[model samples]
Target: MTTFAPPAGPVTGALPLPVRRRPGFSLEGPFYTSAEIFAEDIDRVFSSQWIFAGTEAEIPRTGDYLTVTFGHQSVIVIRDGDDVRAMHNVCRHRGTRLLDETCGTVGNIVCGYHKWTYRTNGELMFAPAQPPNFDKTCFALRSVHVRSLDGLIFICLAADPPADIDTVAGLVSPYLAPHGLKNAKVAARSEIVEHGNWKLVMENNRECYHCDNHPELICTFFPTYGYEPDEIPPNLLPAYDRFLAAENDLHAKCDAAGLPYEAIEELDGRDVGFRIQRESLDGAGESFSADGSAVCRRSLGGFTDKRLGRLSMHVQPNFWSHVLSDHAVVFSVLPLTVSTTVVRTTWLVDAEAEEGIDYDLDELTTVWNHTNEQDGEIVARAQLGVSSPAYEPGPYAPSEYQVEKFCSWYIDAMNAGEPRPEPAGRSTGESG
Candidate 1:
């Protein structure tokens, strides 16, 4: 039998617990800076929810595998035969970490500590010095709940994950299937560590109020996002009119292709909150380049038209993506500690598209690469300000509705006493 060490930190009694968060307002300072609340976030939010791990494109072969680590837990997402499986990355015998590398191909999972061996399917195959009565069947690697929705992978650490994901998958698959993300290949991937809590990173992404800081992105991405018709200020009305015209053109093209373009927003008031839509871009009304033209020569899913706009989707807790005609970009957030987080960005292009011939890697990734760097600086400054004793919860503007919804869902999950996993069925909850 193996014994594990306790967490390295002062006890909860030594610190001041966070105050209860108020609705329609920013979370209290402690919620972002306290060690106690950070641990609770890992338990109530990360562990209990289905997190976007990685895409199937990352593991196109049988032995391909990747390790996702967050809040002291690690999971191995691997491809075995025709199925994708997720297992806790811990040796069953002595509780040692089995795989330390971020990603690689492996015929079998072998523990470095004691040479315990397991198949790609997570079945225990060998244990060198076990008792005669020991049973290999009883020592199989523990499995984590994993599901793939149109090639995007999600994993839940809880024994009974939220069932609302099935309903979410059904509604969003039509918008995603046309892009062929499952068959796509990664063009570029990068990681940046930000000096902020995980929630701050997510909250920063929920609104475009600070988009002026992203000049590269604004060249193609309209600055009128997250605003309703009535809320459009006079300064942005002309841009709004341009957006309407481009939207009309996009709708006509989508109708001809039989693709879903209308928004389906249900940001809160359910087990799984999500929003998806295909919106028009500025300039040439295409990809993320400076002039809004196609970034790659080959189109995704064999679509001839480059003006398909972007199929954008946002999932609660931590996931968002933008699928364009020529390529797609996916973002995943992981917590490192109470005061830091890591954001991983991946760019995907057609599998047959050659890097130098069909697409320029720098041009394909320049927009988002610069945008992320700017966002990271903003989050860091926000963290610094909120750490001061003068900081207080502030009201959220109407244009920032999604941020409020995200905070509400998080607070609800934190306050939901114990796990009451929803039954397997579609949720009929009202849209937000």
Candidate 2:
């Protein structure tokens, strides 16, 4: 048995982190390759922020649970009776991890080390050979703060989680509600350990300047992703023209359905940074299939039109999603080490859609699966380059505005003593 222990203090003669980044530039090399900075990120940014954990579709029935482990922390997001709860995975008796599997169904959580048992609701159910005076109530599993914005689950390790999630939720729910994610079911989920810092993985996601590298994704996903109207280069003019026509058609559909299609971008200057919009896909203007047609026959949320476009949302510091008419795909980033991070992607479809009947599994997952592998390669290469001593912070192109916003949010969260502005109101416009 491999027993896990907390990490020791930093080694002597560690390089000091660059405290602040030059505005509108990439972060320094240490932010992507230093153990000390990685530890600080887990302690400050991830611990303090509201993290996107998973979806309610993950644990649908009582006793169903999913375990999320990042750095030295592990948490269980479980279904108990009618509610979903998050609790520390450590056992009260010997600090043994209660769950080993990434996800499964369990009648009771039993610590393998000492046989201590806990109920789905995290109540202490059994403790063998205990003193009669031992109070079980006092030893219930320590609960973590959890919130479900519609069907999307988020967890916070800190006791006092930021309240801006409520404000962000209010703005996005109108855009997301029509998709009816709560009623959807997990069609497929994949996890890959990318050889890169978590920050590198996120930075890679914030811009489409690298879209040419993703052949499969760029077929349906617009190549003009992060570019402003005036900033798109002549090389991408053809793609931009297609985007405009598809967007106009998408707006007509959204208006008829009363769905919010305008973007609500509030990426920085707040505790909960997010950007969401219902925009058009390329090809057939439907799902993410090779030909851009509906991957599933049944539309999620009872939409009759299969060409409803994609409702895309990106949330810092570690989540993003694309909701199509027939299906949705979600991504979560979890830091594993200074140089390795796990990216989990899940595909969701209508609950009634059967695997062989309504959708073929490979067709449903092909595009994003290829895109994720491409991204993993890009991040690993970036990590290798940044680890070299010659690497330095570089200027971000004007099209990479979201990447800059992400860096700004990260820096603000890392400064524990600094004061930040109130959560900003949602703006109805493109971020870049």
Candidate 3:
């Protein structure tokens, strides 16, 4: 029989969360710098939540798969005919890792350490020299709970993943289905390792307070994001006026197209916090380019107008995406260490769109590529500041409400004995 370490002890054998998070301020420095806290984070939060894996677009074929690794866990997300499945990367026999490449198409999963093989659905297919007495049925690859919401794949390592996802899918699918992300194809993919704690990276994405540093993104994305209309600052009032006008036009267009444009923000007080909306871009009101124009000539979701604005969605702990008339961009964040995080960015366009004829690869990808680089530098500096002994939690501004909400959700998950997920059905606020 195989055995594991730390039978019933804490996985990290670490003390309980070292400090209480102050309301409306950044987390204490140790939360971002301590290995113990990082380990606790993995065992409690990441291991127990519904984490967004890559989109189905990355694995369009029946046998395609992608591997996701964070901390000590690795999962293989594969497409098996009509459904997507998630399983531990470890082989059932001798616990050998079954697949090593980041992603690829595989007829079956075969371990390199030993030749034990499993079918695409993770059923043990062969055990090189096992006796007839050995029960292959007992050794199927351990399965992880997985859900694909309109093509965006998410997996939970926990035995009972948050049931809120069913409700979340129901709420967000109308906003996402029009983009047809499940049937789309990947245009470009990029991965970056940021020099910061995973929380810091998430905080940076929750608000636009520092968007002034993202020149390329700010041109199309409103810098006034997250601010209440009445709280708009004097310096940003002109931009706010432009946003209002664009929103009016966007609403009419959406109505005519039978699309939903209202916002549904549920970023806290639940296990599966999230937000979704279809809002207008600043300039051409199309895509994430300098002029907000459509980068791909071939329209997505059968839309010929090329001006459907942006359908943005954010799911707690680590996932966000924006789907436009021309394409969709998805991001997944995973913790690497106490002071490091890795982010994967994917761009999806119509499967029929030609690289050179219907889209210019550089133009389609330049905005987000540069924006991610700039954010990486910003997160690195934030990490450096948090590591210093003089660091202290600071207050959040009114415009940074979502950052506070994100922190609230993070703390609740970290401190949970059994997370209270939002029930299977929610009508208002998407509440628990």
Candidate 4:
């Protein structure tokens, strides 16, 4: 196995990142092609903010854990007693890396280099040949700030994470709670390494302007996602009409069930940017299937209504999800390099629901599986284009407003965070 490691410092580039950008336009090539900017993104954007890690249902039992990796850092998110906790996945002794596997249950975190052991709660349990002066408390694994909004897990590596996470969570949890993700089980998961900058992957997801590229997705998915009522194109007018009718029905059902269906979009100008709404799917208005019918037979959260539509949410930097009555699909993005990214998509369903009986494995996963592949190709082409010297930033249509917001949020994040210092007086300039 290749032991993963990050670069010592930012790789130098010819052009520095611009502080300001014109509204409704794509970022300049350097933002996508520069390794220096990518390093800054890893530090100022990923490290200092509350990132969507995983779901609580992932580690439902004590000792269960998941590992999240991004750039230089690896974090272990584990269930400790009744609480979920996160810690740096590094052995306190000798700085040996711990928990190499992507995920597995462990009675205790043990360092292979030494016999240093830690409890599931991260307390140092045992260490051979320790000096009398060595305090076990001091040797405990360094903890990361962790919080869960109902079931979605988030972690912050910073000493003080954004305080707005609580505010965002409070506003989002009620809409997410009814899906019962905390009680759900991961039905399926798909991970892909896309040849694109992390920003491109997120920017692609922020709007449906390019959704026409996803044929399988556009079947039930309303391509009118980011379009304003007046700004909607003539070609998509029929879809807009259908969307309006379905939204009315969805709102009525939500009201009857006492669920929140209104849109809450605060995608920018916040420490923890996000957007959420319970919107109607086309056709049967149930799920992402070709006919808009649920792939899972079992309903989530004991919802008697299978046509509850989809509760979709997007968090800045690296996460988005859609919760339907039948199942919930969650996605998280992580950068591997300046021009490569990893996208993980997980499907969750009722804990008691059995596979093959309550849901067909293929049907549960097919729509998004195809959509993700299609998106990967698009991002790869985009990466290639942006890397070319002839490439120039392009204008974004009005329907691409969310994409503009995402870029705005990214710029704000990069500007607001303190710059990371270069290590050992290393120059962050072009070094052949």
Candidate 5:
């Protein structure tokens, strides 16, 4: 197996620091306009990188299974007796998809075209009308690397394991473990199809630089742009701080507030932290602040660590996790064409938390879905505008560091000349 190397530090003069007294930016023209670049991206980026498949909670039983798409490939995650396995969702008989449904429990996966039976564990258990000399062992389902982190599931297409999932988990565990993600359950799921590139969706989610345009939906929750942790309401800050600042007393407060205790715990425990800094925009009509100090506001209010409310996180590339004190939601981005992307968002809650009793997830879902639709409209228009012959790559606001980080990461990965594996981490085991 080929051992994976962690990304190296920025070499001297390799990536120069951003220009001073002016915003700095770079845009590779072909990334958004060329079909060839898109194809290469699928192979080098999506296929190799860890892609969210599903949650282990989605398939709790021995025979439980879920079918999902990784890029254009069909894959299945199933429970096989005592082991959980991920395999290509293809029938050996005629290369047809074995299971067409999104999710379910099955005794055996039997192809509709021909009666080829495979155990839930992905072993070719039975095959009808095989020649006397036929060997079933060689025909077993093709296996893919699978691992679970918290409850999230991830799968990689490459034959050799790219990197240690545990290492990846260690990096983000401090941020996720406190939220009870390890034990969380799926409460609901929804999808949206947008008319823009997948990258556009990611860029939008990476920074909160465009929230005012849709204030009615976002301001109800996150009402301010101040970065001082104290400037925000205790309920608005992540939970970990409460644990440290107030001892365990905050845990009770969080529980009483209906927030996810573990998430807050993780946030507080994290070595590397996040801060929200904002700067008011002037009349120049730019969406961001002149100094890039502030982010755009949208439906900011949701859940926080204090209660099962709302919080948002961008997990590099095309995945996002939105945590509400009571529940959590995840989103995956799939690019269909240069100008089109399909987004799937799923809402998760504790299995015991009844929908209406604990919280109205649908209300939260409606708000977030609408927010996504609004983003779609804006990004689509942006795509059209950028495609104009007169357009030039503009400067990045200094405060828009998240956006800068994202663009820098993408460029670095592309320049590395190697396949990008799923962000190194264990899967949550849920398939969307």
Candidate 6:
């Protein structure tokens, strides 16, 4: 077995290295190309950390279930009457996979290979043609730790969690509450497979540094492009606090008004100066808007006593929350290999809201889909460039604080010698 090397730093228990004081702009190259580094990251980061699973809305009815993956492990998220459960999808008898479909309802789970069966609640039910000495009670589907925030589901592979759900919630609650995510429902889903380290995709998502190169998509939303490190907006500086105060204030107002709130939309074209002229590579007329108000109104809606159209927030690591007037959107980045990743996105709305009648979901989906495609194209190319012998790590611009902060945190996690905080309600036995 390959032993993991912690990042460079003084001994601080078993954690990785400490982030350098100077602008640490680049990750070690091995992170992008080494299978050993990938394995270490899976052990240290993905396994111990809280990962966003599918939302509660995906399995709203009893016996409903959805299959997901963490690292290479297949898992199932199921509604067992009153509680939602997450279990390893592998069968105990000879270890054949229990579920092959992505999702479905089965009164009882039956392993096709040996006909081993389990109840929807994860209890071992029976085994056909078993050895006389085989014990059914001794084997059961392994369970993972799970928690729900608003209606979104999170799972942890670690057996012993370092923190409670409320603490984790506190870290992101400010942003989540404003968008009303706790009661949100799923509307649409999409996925993108990219050829690059997962971190590459995350690095791109955390910064608007490439806005200048995106002629059609993001440039339309943010025309003033700046690749220099020094150009960060003052309000967005100190990345962690960027939307905390604003979100808290919004939540307070909602509470005072007795309104069911989830999240706020952060896509007001006005904030980013939508009226500014931008050049397009397609030779389409120079893009210009009279004001951001039109775009915001169309996407979010008018702010009134009863409605506050949209709000957007990002939790450190790799989750993005786009809170629209009547719904919410979430995006997650999952690493498949050192150079491959699976990107998943979901649109959420009120469980009671009727699709097409309550909102035109296609309108909202189109904007995000186009935006993601644009992002994917750019990052894929960047990945190819990074692999080039001529490529070198660059310095950070003052204005690109968001991207810088993300890098800083990633380095800290990679170098920390100690284990990361665990997800809620998990113990070591529960982790694989």
* TM-scores for candidates 1 onward, in order: 0.92, 0.92, 0.93, 0.93, 0.70, 0.72
Which candidate number has the best TM-score?
4
For model 4, residues 1-432, the per-residue Cα lDDT tens digits are 111111233322222444346667788888888888888888888998888899988899998998998888889999988999999999998888889876779999988998799998889989999888888988899999999998999999988888999899999988998788899998988789999999999999887888878888888899888888999889999999999999999999899989998899999999899999999999998888989998888888999898888999999979999999999999999998999998999999999999989999889899999989999999999999999999877999898888989988887777666466566559666667
Better of 3 and 6 by TM-score: 3
Tens-digit per-residue lDDT, 392-430, candidate 3? 999999989999999888877766523333335743344
User: Which lDDT tens digits does candidate 5 get at residues 255-341?
Assistant: 565433343212111211222111112222112222211121111123232322234454445666655444566777777777777
Model 1 stretches astray by more than 4 angstroms:
1-18, 417-432
lDDT computed for candidate 1: 0.88
- Clash list (residue pairs), candidate 1: none
For residue 424, model 4's alpha carbon misses the true position, in angstroms, by 3.0
Q: Candidate 1, which ten residues in sequence have the lowest lDDT sum?
A: 1-10
Looking at model 5, residue 138 earns an lDDT score of: 79
* Candidate 2 lDDT score at position 386: 92
Angstrom error of the Cα, residue 355, model 4: value is: 0.6
In TM-score terms, candidate 3 sits at: 0.93
- Indicate the residue-level lDDT of 246 in model 2: 96
Give me the overall lDDT of model 6.
0.59
lDDT of 2 by residue, 276-354 (tens): 9888999998989777899999999899999988899999999999999999999999999999999999999999999
Q: What is the lDDT of every predicted structure here?
A: 0.88, 0.87, 0.88, 0.87, 0.57, 0.59
**Clash list (residue pairs), candidate 3:** none
List the candidate numbers ranked by TM-score, top first. Answer: 4, 3, 2, 1, 6, 5
